[model samples]
Target: MTLLKTPLLDTIREPADVRRLPQEKLAQLAAELRAETIDAVSVTGGHLGAGLGVVELTVALHHVFNTPHDRLIWDVGHQCYPHKILTGRRERIRTLRTGGGLSGFTNRAESEYDPFGAGHSSTSISAGLGMAVARDLGGGERNVVAVIGDGAMSAGMAYEAMNNAGAMDSRLIVILNDNDMSIAPPTGAMSAYLARLISGQTYRSLREIGKQIAGHLPKFVERGAQRAEEFARGFWTGGTLFEELGFYYVGPIDGHNLDHLLPVLKNVRDAKTGPILVHVVTQKGKGYGPAEQSADKYHGVVKFDVVTGAQVKAKSNAPSYTRVFAESLISEARRDPKIVAITAAMPSGTGIDLFGQAYPDRTFDVGIAEQHAVTFAGGLAAEGFKPFCALYSTFLQRAYDQVIHDVALQGLPVRFIVDRAGLVGADGATHAGAYDLAYLGCLPGMVLMSPADEAELMHMIATAVAYDDGPSAVRFPRGEGVGVERPDRAEALPIGKGRMVRGTGEGDVAILSLGTRLAAALEAAERLEAAGFAVTVADARFAKPIDRDLALKLASGHSALVTVEEGSIGGFGSQVLQFLTDEGVLDRGTVKVRSMVLPDIYIDHDTQARQIAEAGLDANAIVAKVEGLLGKAKAGRELSRAG
Candidate 1:
């Protein structure tokens, strides 16, 4: 592949170099930066469309603001690829999202330029506000700027921050990157003129003078005067919402135009306003032909051909866990008219898009607001609807309070279809769904099921649909299922029941597995059997309402019992251990018990296989764990014989 010419981008090592360049040359620099961002993402396969959209904005921000000291915060950080390239990281840009390389999102540890690390959306304004307040308390003169996407504005947190920032006197600047859809038409010379005039020092001084004049008037008159001023400005600019929230609003400016972005950013940067919001509009995939044509495909991509824009996707023999869940749910919804699906701005990611295609009225995309999605489903469940709230396990953490207060406490039959339940590759620790089992298992009257395969996933979906007594969740991992023929008709399993997958006879050692780690346990059992030790393998099925009878049977029947799960420490293994202790199974000292779970440390971005191996949840790790346990058991036996 021929490298795109980035002549101007090659000369720049940092934002300081960007500042040194003349304004006329800055446009050329932005073009080079755009080309470089596309080329790098095409090679590395990270977030492309967002970064592409922000190329000029990034150049303008770096050029206008004294970054590193100024504290420029990118809201979601997927769009920070352009920012990353300009912030002395261009040399290593190709290593993005790879193991032991640059992160796909902004990471504070990776660079001082990244004041706050972000993988999730709708956090920049809050973080930037905190920084602004701190800077004021410290008597620092450094500016604080937050650039947030329009989609991120859907979350309540963004508005909460704005409300607080609006009420305060702390100097902060917020740039609303409205790329997906337009709030207003930002065109012609007149719009640019209005943006410049509104943000200009002269306009700000006159506005402050008017506020002073209003303060002297009667309360009613002051209120009327404020309304009139806001009405006049908002009539032209559509900033009344922001003005009411206590921010000096500007723009609906062209984000792609460096000429437009630079002057406005510089105005806000120097303005004495308490909090200012500049609305800048741009296209998601602005430059590259394929990306510009179909922004969604390039939003997140695999390593793609720079010329042809074709992504390199691996061939899969079986359907993905996400696809299987969607298909099963669609099948179930066909039979059940009350069934509904909800997703928090992740229709495609959670396979809710397919469900929507089948039943559009039954599907809801809540738009980057996980908390709202949870409660919305609760309301649906209250109205006799079987609402399946499909969310990534990691994203569900944002709505824990609603999960407890709204759903679980009220005994709402909200079926949580948790996708991405284990170590997610490329996205790293921020996106890892390692804590769902731990968080949800402790909730009373909650039914939690982890499927061992795609077929089991189908059964679990049916189980969740039938479980109308309380809140229930099914968590599956982020990749292709192990090839297993799915059942023709989905059958709901008995609640809290487990099935022994192998070794019917009472073996010397038993491996109790949960979630998708059953395949590893089975493989480990084979290795143990070949080594002249009998091994039994069973799938716990449910993390909560854990298979109590199976737990006792395994504890008493085996000399050594090793519990394995693809979750953190306080999950399935912990549940079993608690049950055994409570039941006097551990008091007898007849069997040695061990638990295998994900490691305490956060694993970096890598292949899912590599990450699971590192977490010691793989077949080899399970075999090693069993071998170690049996060694201790044999030693105890020998000591008893001598005694």
Candidate 2:
């Protein structure tokens, strides 16, 4: 337990406790909260930099606002650790991101303090706007505040909410917590803040008077005045961009200083405004030395040394899939001049940063905007550039409309390199890439492939690069490869083809494994062989296109056909089932067919092995399914004999 006994932190259990404390004591509370956040994250290994950055802001917001009644939404929820500790979750703070414990991100189900759930970026404004709208309808005076990050502002959704809120004239409070970076360094004007503009009372009064003057002026005069204000603001706060979007822009204030945060928050709470945007600039890792120095690396950490600030990572024998993708993409980019890489804020996570190192001009990081990233890649693809749109499986869901309308329907030859395509350990259901296969595979003319390991992923990368007919995708799971030997040069694997890994000329039972589940399929086949059942294993490289010849042969030859995939119900298993049905494979009735896919319900955070087993796609689960099916067949034969 990372529990600390600070005079200030110890007294607080809720927002009411925060309110009860004297305003002078808020600074001490923030310091204690920061220490507690670092200590707790050191043991549990969560989002340390973000929560550390917002320590003062969190205290101020909770203290000033009547929370649970008033809504406080933390965008992306990476900074909610301190918020959670102060809001009745301090005892379970260390249990964050573990199985049956508190979620790393803010979950509404977990606590009333969490008015809206957040995991993906840029959704807080939209959710908070809805809450504010609901409050208006319900005739409630409860405050609705959405604390967003500069990173989240990159997404159009945040702006859309702002636009709507501005037009509707909703009393919404938006705290733009600019840590000066998202995953990588901040891009665009989102990180720009006013230089000492909101530090003094004179400027605040002038800005308020200026807003009143601008509103009363004629349309033409207002435009002229707005331009002049923009020029003045460029020097003062650089918040004209937010102002143009219909938000009352305030600050470029020091987020670390409680003296600054407390009064601004109090003013915002008291002011009758339509969607106010308070620009608070804070360091990502404020108090902690190591985190402050190397913010990105410390953003998400494993259990680490609190004293030295060294992360305690387990030794791995294999290079991670992320690194392998980066290396392979870099190699591909060297040979092809047209090849371009794009990621939605996740430069290092997708390993696109390594590709950027090789070809800086060729790599584009769109920042928290998956929608723009997808369409931007589509535009490049339209221009005959080989744009590899790399995104994590879960994050890509945010841009699925672009994936369908812009890329797939238009038939742009965009290469989608879907990372974290299976159960991502620790990140849990919100971050799982379980639905990519189902969603992407269903698209017409979309070619979907899942690599069994790192070596195969290299080949898939090459395949995606060469394919120009339509949208093509390659999905690979999170973490390291299965220690396969790396090839000096990559070759494109044949489209719509599957390869047999085991069995002789024939076998009674056929196992068609997809994605990273091949290793477990082989393990299950070994178990089946020992039990006197001849088993064959085949790796279905392409989820789309189906590998008809191979699937038909397996079905016609084997007594039993089983499909295994690390995806949801509508993905690889569904594809196999639909294809077999269309081909009349099941009409024969002799082959007992089974499709193993992740269930319809969302599974919580657990070890990858445990998650797969729970999904019944693991080796032991597969073996059990096979034995049960065989046992049923034997009983049927015995009943026939008796009859």
Candidate 3:
């Protein structure tokens, strides 16, 4: 007779259910939990590998600790999917990361269980510390646990929090999930040190025996046993990184084995002393074969075939803009020895992987520290090196103060290769690079340029590197170029210059395009041309310096001017409008000026083309607006002709 399948997980609507389960059945419950996590992520399509890796840890945490009351803060919270599933979000898991769906990261707005919201890395420990301190001041007896990965631990903020927590001696738990990687392979001295610390055989042996002894020790003997335990901890834990920082260090334990994890977690839960750190060793893609082997690929994936683990790749006829930037940087670096590359934990994403492979000595992966990366580049530039600080437009926000104080203040020539400058599809608003233009434009002594296509981007990169006076930025979009043929040799374009893409007669409408949005403007102009309206297109390569000559010429020549950019309203268009007003060009005539840009609201993830259309920055939208403006122009002319 077949035994009935256990309904253990289905009944686990709350932590009470988990707490009720016998210690012997936790392993089976963990199995069911893993299956549920996999199945949930398979449908929802978000942060699969991280959530899968933490299934058992999540189960053990909720089972052992009282959550919502006992705070569990997840750093860089993309790994909190399983936590969300366990905390009454199982049914709504299908909506993850969608416009109205559950958030990809832990959101305090989403649940009481999520004590703090996190998207970027290295914040959990700090947040957890705040909760712990608050709980103490209020005289609440609740545990505070922060689960951070080894990748996130490389970030300086993690250590900053650790340093602060060590001094406070507050009762807290810091779980370091060491799987030997972040988004890419982990970098820096901290990762290397942690790796060596965890791998020591003597430390492991001493840790196991200490935990066994600590579990049996009476409360009265605990204080007296501490002195003896210190010697045992030093023997087992080696350097005592956390201990020195004022934490009771535990583990480097097998995170997968329930038998091993449960006992350690239970012991740590009972400990009422200072901050404790449990170093858990778990594989990223624990059970899934393909994900287990290549964790990064599965880290954040699109919809994929479950059986083969194959993603249906988008058919792009042209190479991605990132590929172009990588190729262009490599070509430039080959010619100039002074040219160095820097990325803040994004070697592959920013296309610096190629440069790192070619010139490993010159390339630097600063590790999830954008602030450090920018300042480091500034330091390099002060030493007469042309440092290209390649970073995503969104991530660059974190280093604004550094960019201004460190680079722009000194007028250092730090070449910022700003990738994903527009609406990045699927990653949504949090990852969108829309605000860089506005922020970068406002900085004093900063020069900003955006390319219309890959070939222009290559020239812009050369221009940024060659310039020696102040910080220069070259912003480009997320996807492939418009299939334009790239030039073989790299050449520097003149700084603070704009180029005309299409010429037109007097009284014609002038379209000033910035960045990759030039393609859409060109298409709009073509449609306007067909309707017997003269249309001129100008690529405003420079945004900050404001190509005065081009703006003056276009204002004098055209009856109507429209500025188009794949950025916020206060970006290229605002600069152009300010120029027109300052030059007394707007006063000369009734020059009907219009600005086309991304809307003021946060746009959701979809195809780039769809996002453009939704924001009314698409080809058809531009054409319609221009045509309407021309109709008014013709009507005014008719009144003049009739008079």
Candidate 4:
């Protein structure tokens, strides 16, 4: 009853430690693990419900299989908190998702237990297959399990992996955690059918009886019983989809029951056949009252009161960027009947929920299928509908090919409202939108723009709607917008133009900035001004076209030019540098050039400011780097005068 005080959990410093415990104590251990997970997430403010749902499953998997050698690949990895706690990270659980702390998702660098790192969904099967192939090539005997959610199963990549795994006859185990929900309520027919199949009590019981009966038969009888067993399985499991894909379909079993999970996993482990998919039914938030009642609210929470299950709200002067985008999109949809919205299972997260509510008939919630969402939007665009494909910058990576082939190549006017455009906090590197600007800009006829503030974002949105040429993207950051008063009328901004935020005349250093990080660059320029260096700051609205005239004019007049953006080195800054190179300004003039960008490595979860600081994109860091460049420029001038 006293789950938290159990000796089994207290003694567990690592998975190896748990392996030493008696099998009889595992149930108590599972209870203690769940309690620890709940307590840890209460302080750390991370994904709670999914982790709570997988406590028993996590324990059973680790107990039955030899990890660090056998390899367990967790899909999406948001549900890996219980997995993390069980795998030697128990003591550090309080530091989850914070700066310089434990990551919220599974990181291969974080632990040997995490064989394959994942933040995106529907990658487990592919990763597991890779490990299986590698193990087979090495003549090694090890079980490879890929635990993916039913939500993740909707993605085309999951089927691609299943199709390949079926053909290879690779010994891979894919666990489908059918909770019937991703972030919000599940979408599409696949989700509905999976929910019905897994929740059927009669089907599950009959399958178990059939397995038991098959086990009692003689070896010769069992050999001849293949067709009969397949028929029985087909009738009971009702998994023609996975069966057709070449996987041995099993279960619809209760995932929370360790007694059932352990035995089932053991039998599957010993089967020694082709790919096997075990469908496990689990509640999103199993035991905890608050989490179980509202799984979505608890999915990714802030620090909350453990007793009341209420989050501590942080006061914000302005609405979040997501909220603003949602409001603007909804308003635009109301005005324009031809306007519609789409999201890849991130309705609430991307603020498409508002558009969905306003235009219920027009909005589409494509479950965890970014690639499909992109192509679908293209189809909608071809039909004379203005479709806004709202997706997180990170998730947009899934649909790069579609963006090029379907949207860009054909020059379809699809508006891509890219949310969480910069360094996304808490979710860490796996969810950072550091590469979108660079990647999107590279596409021919694609228009890429980042807003400096909330008002600018609204303007960009209007501009995206007005532009009926090719694919256009308006990227905005995560969290609350800067407290700038939003304009009542959304106006279309001039395409391929830059805005001068500070300084009128030519200066020693011209700072060209992109995105919300422009605010930081302006502050840095102010500091440089106090130090007697006149710095001109410009917000480069369009990253693709590069605003060559503005950049050339600014660079031509300034003694030195410095480009700044929150994205990676190959982003907006790179565009400016490339322009300067193409214009032959570098060879013709004595202008010292410097670029400020995010570090190449993946940053961990923290506040956006902290992540920016770590990446050396903070105001102080920018100021120091610029001052050094200016000092060098002056030194060269002094040397030339002396000569």
Candidate 4, pairs of clashing residues: none
lDDT tens per residue, model 2, 23-52: 889888889999999998888898999889
Tens digits of lDDT, candidate 3, 292-363: 989888898776767788875678878888888888888888889999999998898899998899999999
Residue 228 C-alpha lDDT in model 3: 71
Q: How accurate is candidate 1 locally (lDDT)?
A: 0.92
Note the clash tally of each candidate: 0, 1, 0, 0
Candidate number with greatest TM-score = 1
TM-score of 2: 0.93
How does each model score on lDDT?
0.92, 0.86, 0.82, 0.84
RMSD for all candidates, in order, please.
Answer: 2.4, 3.8, 6.3, 5.7
RMSD to native, candidate 3: 6.3
Q: In terms of TM-score, which candidate is stronger, 1 or 4?
A: 1
Rank order by TM-score, top first?
Answer: 1, 2, 4, 3
Instruction: Give all TM-scores, in the order shown.
Output: 0.97, 0.93, 0.86, 0.90
Q: Write the per-residue lDDT of candidate 4 for residues 518-617, one digit (tens) a residue.
A: 8888898877887677789999998987898899888888988888888887888888888899889999867988888888898888988888899998
The model with the greater lDDT, 3 or 4, is: 4
> Which pairs of residues collide in candidate 1?
none
Q: Model 4: residues >4 Å from true position, as ranges?
A: 1-4, 20-23, 181-231, 632-643
* Model 4: lDDT to the true structure: 0.84
